[model samples]
Target: MNQGGNKIGGADSASRAKTRASGGGAPSGGSPALSIVIPAYDEAGNVGPLLEEVRREADALGRSYEIVVVNDGSRDGTDRALDELARGDARIRVIHFAANFGQTAALAAGLEAATGDVIITMDGDRQNDPSEMRRLIEKLDEGYACVSGWRRDRHDDALRSFASRIANRLISKATSLPLHDYGCTLKAYRRDALDPSQLYGEMHRFLPVYVRARGGSVAEIVVRHRPRVVGVSKYGFSRIPRVLADLALVRLLFKYRTRPSHLFAKVAGYLFATGALVGGYGVVRGLGKAPILDMPVLLAAVLGVGSLSLVGIGLCCELVMRNHFYVLGRRPWRIARTVNLPDPAATGMVSDRTAPTKAVQGHAPL
Candidate 1:
C-alpha cells in the first residue's frame, strides 16, 4: 500500500507461465473471450464477494474470461485482499496505483491491462448485479460495439438520485449520446471501441459517447441496482462542479477535437465585428462633438485587443492539438505495480498500453 514508489509485483515464473497458457496474460498467444474490469477503492469487504459472483457468472457463460481489478491506492486492506485472491486465481489480475488517483484513472489502468475480445466494466462496491452481465454481453452480440447498463430504479438517497437524474439529462443533451444512466459503471464494450489514452478527468462516464463518435453503435438496457451495504459512497455533492467541467471538456473534445481553430475563429470573428461596430459608433459620436477618449472608444480598443489575443491563442491551441494527435500523447496517471499481468515490452508493445502514440515529454512509463 506504499504510495511513494513504482514497484512491479507478480506471481512466480511458473504461475505466470500457467497464466499465459490459460489465456490470462497478454493477448499475443490467445486472448480470453471476455475481460471483466473492476476498479476498487477501499472496497475491501465487497471485492471478494463481487469477484466470486463474477466468476460464477463467467463460468455459466462457457467462455474463457479474466477479471482485471485496479486497486486505486486504497488505504484499507484492499490491496492485500487482491493479492491473496490473485494468488489463488490466475484469472484475477491486479494493478496498483502509486497514489489515490480518481476512478477515471483506475478505469484507464484496468482497460489498458485487459486482454480480451470483449471487455466489461463495473463498480467494485457490489451495487451492480453480476447476474445481469449476460444481458449486456447478449446485447453486444447483436452487432453493437457498446452496451450500457441503465439503472431504472436506482437505490440511493433522494437528493443524490435527483442530482444524478439532472446530470444525466444535461450530459446526454450535451454529448448527443442518450442514456438513462451515464454514471452506472456496469457496461460492456468491444475491445476496439475503447481508447484508454482519451480518458482523463472524469471522462469514464462518457465512454459510450467516445465509442459512438468513433463510428461505433451504442445501446442501453435496464439493469438491477443494489444499495450499498459494505462501505460508504465515494461520491458527493462536491463532485458536481467537476462533473460539469468535465462535461464541457467532453463537448469541446467531441466537436472540435481536431480543428479547434474553427471554433475559436468563429468567436474571434464575432468579437472583431462587434469591435468594428463600436468603433464606428464612437467615430459618429466624435463627429457630433463628443470626446475622442470616451468610454465607447476605449471599450472598442479593449475588444479589438481581446479579439487579436483570442486569435493568437487559437493558433497556439491548434498547434498543440496537432501535436497531441500526430506526435505526442498523454497519460494522466501512473501505475505503481501489477500482479499476474504480463509486461507490454515482452509482448512487443510499448510499456504504456493506454497511449497509442508516443508518450508526451516528461510523461515516461513507470
Candidate 2:
C-alpha cells in the first residue's frame, strides 16, 4: 500500500496473496484500500451498466478497490444481473436480502461487508455519476472523516427537488451538520470515521452528524447528478413526513446520545414542576371556593397524572438505554456478507498524497 499511510490509492499485494491463499475472498492485510458500496432496490436495468462504469472510473484512479452491491429484496431481475456481473469480476460482491429492508438497512449491510481503508457510498440508480467518485475520494484525502456530495444542479423534477431541499435544510438544522445535500447518496468516509451502528430509520442522511458526534470532521463537494435512466424512484412525497419524524430522534441524539436519561429527565422534570404548581394552585383555590367540580380541578388532575406518567416513562427509557448499551452490546448496523479481507489504509484528500502524477487515459467522463 502507499507507504505514506494517507495516500488515496495503494495496496499491499503480498498480504492480499496470503489472505487469498488462506481461503479469504476479500483483500487481506487491508489491501483493497477503497470500497464502494451501492444499495439497489429493483435496479435490474441499472446495476450492470452502473458496475461497468464504476469499474472504469475506479481503474482510472489506479486504486485497489472492491465494489459491494446490496440487493434490497428487489422484486425485479436485479438478482440475476448482479450474479452475472459477479461471475466475471472478483472485485465485485453481491448481497441479497430476504425481504425489502429499505435503503437504510441495505446501506448498513453494505457498510458491514465493506473492507477498505475508505468507504464510498452511492445510489444504485444511474443518477450519481461514477466519475464523481474521484472528487469525493480526493476530498477525503484532506483529512476529513467524511466528504458528502452535493448535487448542486439536481436533475430531478421541480417538485421533488424542492421537497428534497426543504428536507435537507431541516436535517442540517436539526443535526447542526450544515450539509447542503443530505439526500445525495454519493459520499466518501474514512474507515474509522463511520459508526454504522449509530444509524437506523432514514438517519443514513445524517451520516456526517453521526461521524461528527464522535469527534470527526466533515466536508462537502459538488458532484454531477443525472436523471435516472432506469428503475422508478422508491421515494415519494410520503417520505417527507417520515423524515420529519426522524428529525426529532436526530435532535435527541445530537443533544443526548450518550445520556438518554438527560432528555427524558429534563422533559419529565418540566412536566412535573408545571403540574405540581398547577395542582397546588387548584387545591388552594378549591379550598376557598364553594365547589371544585370544574375545568380547573380536572385540568390539574390530568396534569398531575400526565407528569407522573412522563416520569415513569423517562425512568423506563433510562433503563432500556443502559441495557441496550451495556447489557446487550447491541450494534446499530448489521452485515449479511463479509469479504473479511485485510484492506489498506484509506487516506484523506491532500494534493501531495492523492493527486495522480500522470493523467489517466482511456477514460471518458460520465
Q: Clash pairs of candidate 1?
A: none
Q: On a 0 to 1 TM-score scale, where does candidate 2 land against the true structure? A: 0.71
All-Cα superposition RMSD per candidate:
10.4, 12.2
lDDT of 1 by residue, 209-308 (tens): 8777766777788888999989999988998877886786677667876776787778678777877877677676664576645566656578677766
lDDT of 2 at 208: 74
Q: Lowest lDDT 10-mer window, candidate 1?
A: 2-11
Q: Candidate 2, residues 12-129: lDDT per residue as tens digits?
A: 2232211112123345675587899999999999999999999999888777889988888888998888888888887898877667778886787677667787789999998999
Candidate 1 local accuracy as lDDT?
0.76
Each candidate's TM vs. the true structure? 0.75, 0.71
Q: In terms of TM-score, how similar is model 1 to the real structure? A: 0.75
